[model samples]
Target: MKTAAILNKNQLSKDDITHLLMLQDEHEIELLYKKADEVRKKYCGDEVHLRGIIEFSNYCEQDCLYCGLRKSNNKLKRYRMSVDEILSSAKAIHDTGIRTIVLQSGEDIYFGSEEIRDIIKSIKTKFNTAVTLSLGERSFEDYKMWKDAGADRYLLKHETANVKLYSMYHQAQSLRDRIGHLLYLKKLGYQIGSGNLIGLPFQTIEDIAEDLLLCRELDVDMASISPFIPSPYTPYKHHQSPALTDTLKTIASARIVLKDAHIPATAALSALDEKGRERGLRVGANVVMPNFTPAPYKAYYEIYPNKYLTTEDPVKRTLRITAMIESLGRRISASQGDSLKQKVLA
Candidate 1:
């Protein structure tokens, strides 16, 4: 493929990215994945960063069409962990020697800015870990407060780049507003993670390309390219799950486009296929997020069904992921897995 020929030049236009995203031939796709894996090794090295995710709250206010936690899901049960409970979970993650703890939830307002800042402060104070927040969009003050509290990173996946599709799914706000929050978070000195969703009903390859372009434009430090796993309680419940091939292609493309960014082998892939995460690592992804949300709440925090893997003991889970990473000929890093681009700039 001529696309692969130019990938080495680091001069991809939207059309070039689109061409790579649209690679339908199995051989061509495999070649693309190979090049992406090479880029991942060359830029990020062989250390797989294990980020433990604590889904502290299932409560969300957004009514997006695809989410099981959307405000529209009346049948879903939601809960928020108290400060002590969250601290306990963070300690569990810390004990596993994981350097990053991602505090993720729906946009649950129950925990105000002070509550979140306290959580961030406690995690940093108690452990040698960096904090990443995925609590949806908040005010500039809220973002800045969390940053001041020692939050090291933030991940807000810009689900789609097409304005029309973004408006369709995100009825409450515009794509422009979402982008504004991400940019503001960047200004606050957070290692930004902005990503796109693949396999929407009417989404085209061009839309995916635009997503890659937006990530590059924002200079995101981390990115996630996961398939749209249709959820039962949402409007997209009847929609078909995206093919694993397409999602893998998108992941590889992100690795090539955002060469130094930390891309995860998303769980949605593993849920769709047993070997998804392994396949993701084979292609280009360099991070894996093990669910550390205590088991009682794990079953209920159903974003998409059959979540990748969770266990009663987070230590055991981390050990399992550790073996998996080492088996892949990659070592799980003890470092915080900070962005390579930022270090280069510094």
Candidate 2:
């Protein structure tokens, strides 16, 4: 009743929000998840969007401390897929009934604006799938070019809204610049997707609340609220990942607040706990992005270890995910899983 009352009221005190964040008991956690799922059903419906992610490259220029693909990590082998290989992967994803393909890579400059443009253009021209890019920060011209090339969305995770922690991990970058990129992507007509990393060192409950608040303020099409898993090669590798319960609390709170935004039951959550993703789905997540990156590369694109989102074989993986979705009594989304916010504005 307290949860319902707090959510129902137009405004909640910081203390009320802090209470929401501190919910750790199984019964209260279930209540929070149930409420989030109900709100999700109200806004996003029962269809779970599956975005086939192809990790096309691992070459990065930035040395972000927590990521394995940082520029200074010479021990990690790097590879960038040719345009043909990427297109071939997209075609395979389309063939398997996936409506969207996310071309995610490290912040590598090997692929120039025209090169990335050509890849985006080819994917849009050849397949019926929507293209989403996660190529870190790029020039405004590059963003405009890709949008003109028919890229449907751009995902640039804010990572965390706390400026201090963000600066500590990102070195010279500021939260303002990160947000500026998201705003620029939005201005270029791409459905902008931004999210936060839960359970980072020095992250507080207030920080978690602010993350959701920022997502609402941005009116992002998608918000990825996943638990933080420290990479082996990163500086804070020995640091602990977020507790599963803490992750679920953050996910549920985001759902209740964002309501209509598409939140994925992230692979990181599943990596931490075998049923974590399923629990997320039961609560608030309406999307699952299975790795469609063909093998040898999929295992190599390790942002964190022990990620088992999908197998090398796309066909078998699709069947397995479909069965998993069916088990949860949710239908697989058949369309391009376009932003529900877009429809709301329309």
Candidate 3:
């Protein structure tokens, strides 16, 4: 199939998506990126939404093969920030003009749902900002509690849509169950986000195509297309990361397929290349999530090795990120960065 025709299509079939992902010709790939950029411009404007992430805890129960923070990794130094510390970091994020506060941690139920709910309430009351929870998968009751406590969004990356691979990587975690949690979160009125990792071992172009299709089917408010960077102390430590071009193509394709969804130039991209985030913005990504996890803890929240900005001061990093966004002819968003989709609860 011709690249032009594929790019011009209003609706993409699974086969069409597969073919686009398989495009190796330089000119055709460029066309795919151009179409994605055009679609991004039409659906999402030139404002790069910033979400300040605070990885408060590095403790995780499940031992996923790719993550460095897995429970089995004895070498990792785990720490959980106190509520006062978490609120302090959130204040730092707000002072820098970031409106979304993303409280991300591994699946550490030690904080209990009520503890998390209190933190959510404190942040909501202390600062007029959006609170996004990424504390792994939790119960539906816990989700309702957090929502009632003023949590505005939830990010639970489906990681991959292929059933066999999902089980293989997540230690038998069910993809159906993950999807169920995402659906239930949306049902509770929180703007939901989910995504897949590019270039996992044994993953094929067909699998990636299915991942993009899943994002569209879910009608996610945000979709993150990030590279699979191998971590230092994991089972797939030596596996090669995906090519930069492949990652870029996936992001561009995602924008074309899910036009109005907020796509982020993820921090993992920067670990792949210094200009990875900027490159992602040019293609189709409209959101940038900068980590504000305090130093001692930030360095330990290494889901992957050589995490971008793990050591930089949050204030300095925010300034640099602001300058970088401006360099791309984009401005930082002032709103709490609400969902682009029209509200229709399931």
Candidate 4:
């Protein structure tokens, strides 16, 4: 059976993507990966853009059923870094020549609008780096405040676009509110980013396709695509995770559909497979985020189970990923000097 390529090469119907998802043979998976890699080379080339990730806080108010940092998870230890500690971490990351610092956290109420604004200001003031915030959901007022305070970008993953599935996973969170916040961020002149999980419980091909379409329609500046890994503490712990191949297919499809958006080979992808990040870059992913938080607080930054490999140091992990990209004939960029428009144009 011949399947269409969906976005660029050919017009793939929804059924083609379904057929691709149903293909389980190892050789078939390899073929898909190879095709995806070729597509990456055709579009993004081999250069990998590294963004420094600093998990500022783990205290979350929302009880998302799939996340390890949900408030109900009593087994996990929680911490929040002070402004000075965060700045110090950013300084170290900057010293490594990384040009963007992504400050991520759960929906922690402890840091209000003013506090977050100050944090963004301090990071920008102290270091010559771009600031990206991943502080979950916030009001429009808060979003405007943060953007005004020098936050160049904001990441808020929709997790899943299907409303019923979204409610099932989020328990008490509303899909409308989450999407509304994202639209609010976009309206506030921030480089907005949103994404979905690959294989959550009750996910279908139609659902994944809709997700890709939504990313296109919303015209997000960046999209993060990662496979769903079950957290042992979550209620959905027994659900099987999506195959890494399916994740790769979704990433490739995303690249084709959202051609101009900045897509990252997410660390979640790397966690599932050793060469996940490298393969992602070879298949239309141009961004790679390296954890740059202090070693003492690294373990406390968990959003999901077994995130970031335990065997290697954080800096070592970055170097290793960079080396893999270099092996693929791509360079790791030293500067985050390019604007979102500039990256899209490139």
Candidate 5:
């Protein structure tokens, strides 16, 4: 099938998505990326929103098969940032002129609902920034409390859309329940971000197509298309990482499909290719998350091995990322970079 024909369509079918993912010819793949770039410029413009991410805690309760932070991974050292320390990191992110602060950690219930609420309230009160919580799944009450406490966004990656695959990757977890959390967060008026891991063991191209379609179905405000990087001591430790080509293709396909959604060129992309961030921006990505997780604690939050810029100084890394974004002719977004879907809803 001609790639241009599929790219020209206003709406894409699962079959069209699958075919685009399977693009192999060098010129054909370039064409796919060009179309994605055009669509990205049309919807998101040239501003690359930088979201400073702080991986506050490494402790997790679930035993996921592919994550280094899984509870069963005794080889990993666990640590949690105190409330004061978390605020310190948020202040650092704020000082750097980043308008969005993402507080990400494993599903650690130790920081109970009240503590989480307090953290959200403190950040909002002190910083002129948007707080995005990526603390994994929690009760509906907790979600509402945090939202009421001024949390602006919630990120819960579905991991995979296939029910059985989701179960296999996350033991004792149900894909249905994960999607339920995403929907509830959306209904609660928090802009939601969700996406899939490309090239997992036993995953197929068709499954990736469905992943993008699921993002559209959920009407997510942000979609992250990241490659699966194997973590040491995990079940898939020896498994090979996804090809950079496939990862880029997924990003391009996602941009073509979820045009108005915020798509971030994740740090995992850089771990795959030296120029991954620049490559992503050239394709369709409009956001780049800079890690602000402070030292000692940052090193231990390894969901995967050798995360890009895991230990770099926050200021230095931000400077380098800014230069790269500028080199691509993209400007840094100064606003909170809220949900693009807001205008449509309003």
Candidate 6:
């Protein structure tokens, strides 16, 4: 099939996306990425927004098969930051003039409602910056307490929108429960963020299309999509990872489908392709999450294989990504307001 013909098929159905994924032609994928990049540039412009991420805890209760820190993995070292420690980290991030701090962790049982609330309160009071929580699923009361404590956004990736495939990865977790939590978060007036992995052991392109459709249906404020990277400790270690070209195509298609959601040029995307981050920005991704975790704990913050481990040095990763954005004719803003919302809406 001609590249132009494939690109012109604007309303990509499940079958179409599936067909594109199956095609192993490198030339076709590159052509699709270039076209998608052009479209992304037209809509989003040549600028990247940076979000500083702090992986607060690695202690998780869930046993997700693909995650390195799953509860079943007893070999993994687990750690949780005290409220004071968290506040100190937030203060350092604030000094960098990065207004957004993403407080992410695996679903840990150690921090109950009160502890989580205290952490959120401390960050909000001390730094006076936007707080985003990605601490796995929580109850309505817990979410409300955090929101009331001044959390502005929440990210909970659905992992995969396909129910059966979701079951394959998450044996103990329920798809209904995950979806309900996201919907509940939305109802609680939190800026909801949900997404899926691009390629998994059994994921089809139709599954990816369904994920995009679900994001639109939910009216999500942020959509984080990353290509599946196999972990050595995980069950699917030997499975082939998604091709870099396929990953970029998914990002481009996502930009076209969910034009108003904050799409991140994920570290996984960048890890897969040499210029994946730059290409993603050109193809509709507007947010880049630079790590802000302290150096001593950097190696322990692995969610997937070969993840970009950021140092305690606040501006190291941020500055590098900023320069890359500049090289691509884009600028990274020091001000951390919700520029994502503004750009998506514009």
**Clash count for each candidate, listed in order shown:** 0, 0, 0, 1, 0, 1
For model 2, what is the error of residue 124's alpha carbon versus the real structure, in angstroms, after optimal superposition?
0.7
Clashes of 5: 0
Q: Give the RMSD in angstroms, all C-alphas superposed, for model 3.
A: 2.4
Error of 6 at 60 (Å): 0.6
Quote the positional error of residue 181 for candidate 2 in Å: 1.0
Q: Which stretch of 10 consecutive residues in model 4 shows the poorest summed lDDT?
A: 337-346
Index of the highest-lDDT prediction = 5
- lDDT per residue for candidate 3 within 1-346, as digits (tens), equals 5789989999988888888888899999989988998888788777789999999999999899988999999999989999989999999999998999999999999999899999999999989899999998999999999999999999999999999999999985889999999999999999999999999999999999999999999999999899999988899999999998899999998998998899999989999999999999988999999889997888888888764455779889989999999988889999988987753222
Listed in order, each prediction's TM-score against the native is 0.97, 0.95, 0.97, 0.91, 0.98, 0.90
| TM-score of candidate 4 versus the correct structure, residues matched by position | 0.91
Please give the distance, in angstroms, between residue 267's alpha carbon in candidate 1 and its true position after superposition: 1.4
Which pairs of residues collide in candidate 4? 46-330
Best by TM-score: 5
Give the total clashing residue pairs for model 2: 0
Which residue window of length 10 is worst by lDDT in model 3?
337-346
* lDDT scores of the candidates, listed in order: 0.89, 0.86, 0.91, 0.79, 0.92, 0.78
- Tens-digit lDDT track for model 4 on 1-346? 3433333354445566566556677666556656666655555566567898999888999999888788888888888898888888888778877889999998998989999899889888888889999998877888888888999999898888899988888888888888788888888888888999999888998899878777877888888999988887778789888888788888877776666577899988878887788778866788989887775667876666655457556677777777787887889876673434424223
Q: In model 5, which runs have C-alpha deviations exceeding 4 angstroms?
A: 307-310, 342-346
What is candidate 5's lDDT per residue for 93-210, written digit by digit as tens? 9999999999999999999999999999999999999999999999999999999999999999998999999999998899999999999999999999999999899999999999
Q: Give lDDT tens digits, candidate 6, residues 223-293.
A: 89898887777787787778776776777677666665778988888667667777777666878887777
RMSD (Cα, Å) for all candidates, in order, is: 1.8, 1.9, 2.4, 2.5, 1.7, 2.5
